[model samples]
Target chain A: MKPTRVTNTIRALRFAHDEMTQADLAERIGVTRQTVIAIEQGRYSPSLEMAFRIARVFGVRLDDVFQYPDSEEVAP
Target chain B: MSKILYLGEAVVTHEEKRAWIMLVVSVIAYAGYVAVVLGRQDGGSLTAVPYVGALLWTVGGAMVASIVAEIVMGMANPRASRVKDVRDREIGRLGDHVGQAFVIIGAVSAMLMAMAEWDWFWIANVIYLCFVLSAVIGSLAKVIVYRRGVPQW
Candidate 1:
């Protein structure tokens, strides 16, 4: 499958928060560690509610956690 | 030590194991049915072979086997998390959708065969084949998604 256009900073946020493990973040967000791994690797894009929940765990805004590539940014 | 083994082994989730179980059981059951029916052919008309009993036994056996396998797996891995997370649910839904297409095809084929005055053997076998294909393909899809990540959109 193609990588998701959405990118996230979950790994960075997890590192900032006492170097939290993926399992810890998954438990906090009610998802599997694999889901967290996928999201961090840009292999899967979380649902809107899930995205908010993830950001809430990191105490950040949705955009702070996730970013969509801009059309202009893609065109070199 | 367990840590060394863990580092060497690929991480697998409970749902992925269940998918593997389903895929394996379906293929085995279908193969068993085919074997029994073909073995009975005895150089005669294939339709005359008694397939209903074999079909029923294999299908029923598959269900029982799957449940038993799952129970055994759970018993063996007492510490494995049994929770079905959102990603698991989504993957299951996606797999079911992919599998359901084969079910529709099976149903349509059965209907057409019945209308065409085909023997019960052909109709029943067609439906059974499709059901097995559905289970196999669906489980495969789930395994692939688990390994490769769910497709976005």
Candidate 2:
């Protein structure tokens, strides 16, 4: 697996949101289930538009859905 | 939650399985073509041989086999899942770019051979070899990218 500085709370949010499935999130985001799986596994990072879309699907802000750990630790 | 099985092994995704099928089909078709062409040569130069028939058969067979394999794969996994996504598209483009390098290499080599007044047999075979290499290497790259994570850029 490739290392990524970016991380996300999608899996947790999905579980918290009425136990939403990956397929559910994917359908809502207009992407494939595999894409959702990839994102959850940190194998892929979505585009900015997709990141916003994902946040919107969960009724959350972009920062609540995704985080850049390296940048976060450095900024503050 | 159904999965497609090939030779008793589960295939993860439609695109991955398709890559495997294309690789296999290309190899088999190319091997058959080489065998037939070389078998007719009897240790003589193959320059006089007519290869259009073999070339057509190999290319056509690979295409047909790939289509059939995809159809069967779809039937086996009838969830109507999305066939592609952003990641898939990126990986595909990466593979195509890698494979295209071989096509350029082949073209340049063929041009050099033509300048050297090589036989048509050599030029044609070189071009065909390059195409086969492109397909095989490209599909292999896609399979690798599917298994490993695609590189971040």
Candidate 3:
């Protein structure tokens, strides 16, 4: 069965980080604000590189910002 | 200031009335043209006239419409054609991908038809089908990508 799922608080985290605008994060990571919006809303799952970039921007590990609610996800 | 370039606001530059007028005129013209082609005294050959006329008329009309619309829009706002956003880029990319698929599918089908001794009429139909299908599928993909928040493709 597909388990009940949940999403992240990247938007909240960004706000906590001095109210960073989507444009600011997008510019830092060479994407667009629309892409940033998509990610924060869980409508898009970013590529590994993009996830790392977002983590770097937040000055934290990737897991600190994003996590799948299920416990069976692969670890690298 | 590091060379501040002003971004133009999004607004409907081309008047809807002008656009609708152009639309109706083009539709009437094309329909009249097709009717004339179909009503010939000799009732000319389907291969010789109707199909060719359609391919010519539809494409010619579309080109004319695009040019007219672009000109009208540009008249209202010089930068009406510029789209400097990620959503626009993704939509265009989605179109390009669908178009590529159409070309590949058409070419393969044409080659198979050629091997079976199909003639030039078949090739012409194949080309027309390629273009029509490409446009339809491309537009559909664009809508899908845009509403669904970006496509993996």
Candidate 4:
């Protein structure tokens, strides 16, 4: 199977949300700020619940914020 | 900050009791070991009494610290450390990797030293340095794994 890396527009989304800090985002999602950071840096991919929580924060569809390496197929 | 996301606090549990315990025990053991090693020098002062005590103290300290850590973690969250977490497993994995690296380096260095006309100091340093580096790297690896999650084995 493929080792799919998480790719996200979280930085852009945060900026659009009135320059919300990583701390702000993490608090809203009920996880640590470091977790938000790891997610943004692609060092960590959050749980599905966390992903949805993040998407909801930016008021965007999950796909809008998070993209798979392959545009057509499901993530590995 | 927004409650939905950045609760803002990253409160890793306080293992102060265990930490302090380890700190005192470790310091004393290290001091004892150093004293014994130094006493055996050319300007030797003490007898072999300190050497025996140092060995016992170091081994005892390590064993006690391990148990204390386990107990403290168990108290903090019985479920959390029920089995090895992603963090511990990752740390162990990295420790194993670094340990293997040190073993290879030590073997090569010792072989080279055996063939060459060098003092025991060089060979001793090689052996000591590998052991220390493996431990330090292993400890740092634990911190990294805890900070950054590892889902896969």
TM-score-based ranking, best first?
Answer: 1, 2, 3, 4
lDDT values for all models: 0.87, 0.83, 0.61, 0.60
Please write out the lDDT profile of model 1 over residues A1-76, one tens digit for every residue: 4547888888888878877778788788888777777788886788999999999998999999999877654544
Q: Residues B34-134, candidate 2, lDDT per residue (tens digit)?
A: 99998888888798777889988889988999999889888986765646878788888989999999999999999999999999889988999999999
- Which candidate would rank higher by DockQ, 2 or 3? 2
Clashes of 2: 0
- Clashes by residue pair, model 2: none
TM of each candidate vs. truth: 0.89, 0.85, 0.59, 0.47
lDDT of 4 by residue, B23-120 (tens): 45445545666665676655654332235455555657666866877677667666331322222343467656855677678878888997896666
Query: Which segments of candidate 4 are over 4 A away from where they belong?
Result: A1-37, A45-76, B5-32, B39-42, B45-53, B76-91, B106-129, B144-153
Q: What share of the true interface contacts does each candidate keep?
A: 0.27, 0.30, 0.11, 0.07
Q: Which residue pairs collide, candidate 1?
A: none
Worst 10 residues of 3 chain B by lDDT: B1-10
Docking class of 4: incorrect
Candidate 3 regions exceeding 4 Å error are A1-6, A71-76, B1-45, B50-95, B112-119, B149-153
- lDDT (0-100) at residue B72 of candidate 4? 70
Question: DockQ of every model listed?
Answer: 0.34, 0.28, 0.14, 0.12
The Cα error of candidate 1 at residue B88, in Å, is 1.4
Candidate 3 scores an fnat of: 0.11
TM-score of 4: 0.47
